[model samples]
Target chain A: MTAVVPPAPPARLCPSLAAVYRAQLSRARGARIPLLFVATFQSIGIMVLMRGVVDGGDGDEARAVVAGSAVLVVAFVALNLLAQYFGQLRATGGLDHYATLPVPAAAVALGTAAAYASFTVPGVVVTAVCGALLYQLPMGGLWVLLAVVPLAGAALAGLGAALGLLAPRPELATLCGQLGMSAALLLGVLPEARLPEPVRWLRDLLPSTYGVDALATALEPGPDWGSVAADLAVCAGVGVAALALATWAYRRAALR
Target chain B: MASSIARPWPGLAAPEHTPDGTASAPAAFTVRGLTKTYPARRLKRSRTAAEPAAPASDRITLDVARGEIFGLLGPNGAGKTTLVKQLTGLLRPDSGAITLLGHDLVRHPRRAARLLAYLGQESTALDELTVALAAETTARLRGLDAGAARRERDAVIEELGLGPIASRPLKRLSGGERRLACVAAALTGSRPVLVLDEPTAGMDPVARRAVWAAVDRRRALDGTTVVLVTHNVIEAETVLDRVAVLDAGRVIACDTPDGLKALVGTEVRLDLVWRGEPPLAVREIAALRHLAAVAGRRWTLRLPPDRARAVVAAVTQGPAFAALDDFTLATPSLEDVYLALGGRGEGLVRS
Candidate 1:
């Protein structure tokens, strides 16, 4: 006689990260229209201001121009953080509603991180193109440029998610974002030579520092793969660790 | 004479049993010794300071049967939502067991997730998404294919009478419509168990009826078990097969609607409007044993299940009772049952 086994229970259904990514993309696209308009006009204005100063410069002058544009990119990123976090706080409801879904806390955190990353795409592209046009730097490695930009944006987005999770309320999140942006801009974008040793060391620890460094290396006449790889690794590590913390914090809050 | 006839039904043959040998039919869900305690701050006013904190949500247990619409009746701060959260896996219990479809809740939450759908008190749908999109998203989250997701969304929309406004963004919908959209999202996958917390709040009579009809259809067509947390006793009377009345995080009473009403031991008041003054013989006829009290132009009779018909016959046939202008009988309703089970004052406010 043969024995019959009962069938296994049906598998649980969980939404894929791609679906969460898509939902975030749709939301970001809606919120980015005005931000894009402002970034376009701002990029054009910066390009016009830089055209005369570069004046078909030599390699040394070109290096200086690229460095200056990196500073501009860092500043632009800071502005992006300010606008994105404040707008999200004012426009969307708090994350309390998402906690009720059967989705894991990590998925919710990843969704918001992906949304912030998507919002940065237009600004980063415009800044890169404007920097190349104004400084007459090499732009042949388009694929590499694409890869580096997203990694940097992911790092920044993860930091934003961590901040959003830690802040007591939406208003507090906006305030903290503004303060952090101010500190980063002060240390990194201001003339580096004038900063003291301790301040310079602190700036190096910021994720924005690595992002600005990678952008400069990407636009240089000769590609610096070593520096690029180092920056990308550091940024990626920060992003993963911060995102993991945010996920854990969110889970603790929801479960409590 | 009537009292003698009312004492034999309990001795009759019992109902047939199932193959499993349990006295009652097997229930779809059974919970034992469930407990959830949340740390809450204790606020105290003194000369200098406030006190610290304490634990809430003491131990509680419940059982629900197949196709039974059970109400978890409670007032504010009664831990009804906390229990619902634990049952849906949003929060873990401090201790105890919950078995649904024979699967342990804590050890096998993922398996339990497939069979249960929870509609939380908040309308959790995205405001920017259209009603159809919201329903389709939830269906997809429940792992339905694209085609199946659309079909299920359409079916739920139609069932909830949301077809007319299906394409409208959730932000544009009225409060009731928004609540219905949330319910539609929860119901799209057609899971076998539904945990609804005040689903009918903010709904008009028409919308409320539509929600009840959808629940009825789900139960009848699929034998789905529904656990409803509602305070609307009037509407609940028509739909609930049984109820668990809760007070201060405790289950005060759990029973079939008829059984709970029986616990109240309420009597039917027969108001006999006799013309002028009636004869003393009629008063004597109303004074039968087991009848609690007889007053002016009214006889309050405690009619047990067996004595109801005989009592009515004797009152109508007695000669002195011939001058009656009108007579009416009032039995215990669900509201009375609710009040009898210690749910009174502010607790009786219908949702």
Candidate 2:
């Protein structure tokens, strides 16, 4: 007869970062995939509508439209969704689960942001490819989009997380996320020459605009890698700072 | 009656010592001068504005011995949840020190976290994940490897009889099912100390028994220390090695279940059924506090232990002795002690 045995002892501390990232990724697999598809389809639809209006535009105009449309996908999946997710989590008392765990607050915040941002990659790539094809722009430096998606996602997702954490109600959080996405749309999709000087400065302030600038520059026929690198650097710096702020917000929300 | 206390309470004096006079086991948790205050959200306008707001948890202190199942009993809004949250490191205390498993909770909360598993009163966290995933994920987060997490999850699911809804999302389950799933997640981990807050609140009898059985298994097998915060004091009394009664943010009393029960020493209850023609002498017995004489057939009475013999003789010594049926003499229970100390018994309050 076989004797029953107790299971082996498990680790006392929270799992490693890879485990947390894996868990978050798996959790978002079902909920995020459909949202990514919607984002991709929305960006492609915008490009199709703008095609007739920008049919006989300069290369700069074409680059702006394509880059703006592509980055909009990142705004939708990374910024908008992440803000709403964290807001709902806080409102519903879901943060207590992580707070009680042995994991660091940074892991919970960073892992969630990274997972949500990662989902935007597919939509960003699809929109970039489709937008360039429709606008008749050069795709020579399009490989630069690989860096643009995550860096921009980090910047936007971080803001969304902070907004969500600070919002008193989940509904308010959703509104903030929508406003952020709309700002991305208005500032990012339009060619810079069409905007007034003041509004152009506002566009420069938007984090996604830097992402748009990088991707748009990469699409130029004689792309200046130096300028693109600078734009990407700004995006990276903003992403890191925004994520740090989001993590701080997470700690504050937990205390509350 | 005044000398009935077996020993000076741990709060009034040092903790009760074992026969060897050495402290039994190392304390699983030690809380001292733990105080937390929040701004009075519903302050009465008539009060003097200069008065300080009341603390949510007053200067509370206690020690829970290792391998002991300790029950934390209190009424609603008695700072029970607040205190447990502080113990689990989810809430910070305004002023105090907490040491859990020998690690200072405030200074090294991560280290303390590794030693404790908490089941909160609410189950919102489980709603997003499937029952199996929720249990498995919590197990993983507690430091279980992939294979061990799955094994523990499966074991807990089977123990809790959650197989039917194991694959379903927690949001879709009934409230009791969700509670059972939460219990499964909490108990599946091997953390040395477990704090469960109102775990049986929504469970059915079968599920409640399952939860208690699992906790009992953990205690018996690994000598795991458990801190159970519960409203179901009657059920909790069966397994509790020691209990602390909290009222208005302070620990009023802490003792073994028997010790608590013994506070109202030998207070017996007599239940009787009367037939037709209720005897005047039995009905007029001064010591008997009559319950209900339904249809002149059933009757229950509560009285002091010293009056029991006199009342029993009064009923049986008369012609109505044969009329009495289903007579039962009962000793006092934990509920009696709870009502006498933690609740409305104002005279039993300790400083």
* Best candidate (score: DockQ): 2
User: Candidate 2: where are CA atoms >4 Å away?
Assistant: A1-15, A33-45, A48-52, A56-59, A133-141, A166-172, B1-23, B42-52, B265-335, B342-351
lDDT of each: 0.62, 0.77
Candidate 1 Cα deviation (angstroms), residue A37? 5.8
Best model per TM-score: 2
Listed models, DockQ each:
0.09, 0.21
Show the colliding residue pairs in model 2. Answer: none
lDDT of 2 by residue, B1-351 (tens): 111123222222233333332235455677888999876655567665555667879998887766678888777767788899889888888999887755677775545557778898777656767889889888777777789889999999999899999988777788888989998988866776889988877678899889988987777666677898875667657768888887778887888878887887777767767766466555544334344324356565556866766777777866768666657777876656766674642322111
Report the C-alpha lDDT of model 1 over B152-192, residue by residue, as the tens digit.
98899988889899988776789888888888887877776
DockQ class, candidate 1: incorrect
In order, the interface RMSDs are 10.0, 10.8
Q: In order, what fnat does every candidate score?
A: 0.05, 0.29
**Estimated TM-score for each candidate:** 0.72, 0.79
Candidate 1 residue-wise lDDT, A38-121, digit = tens:
545555555566566555433544433443344334334433453345335323433334443445567666665665566656
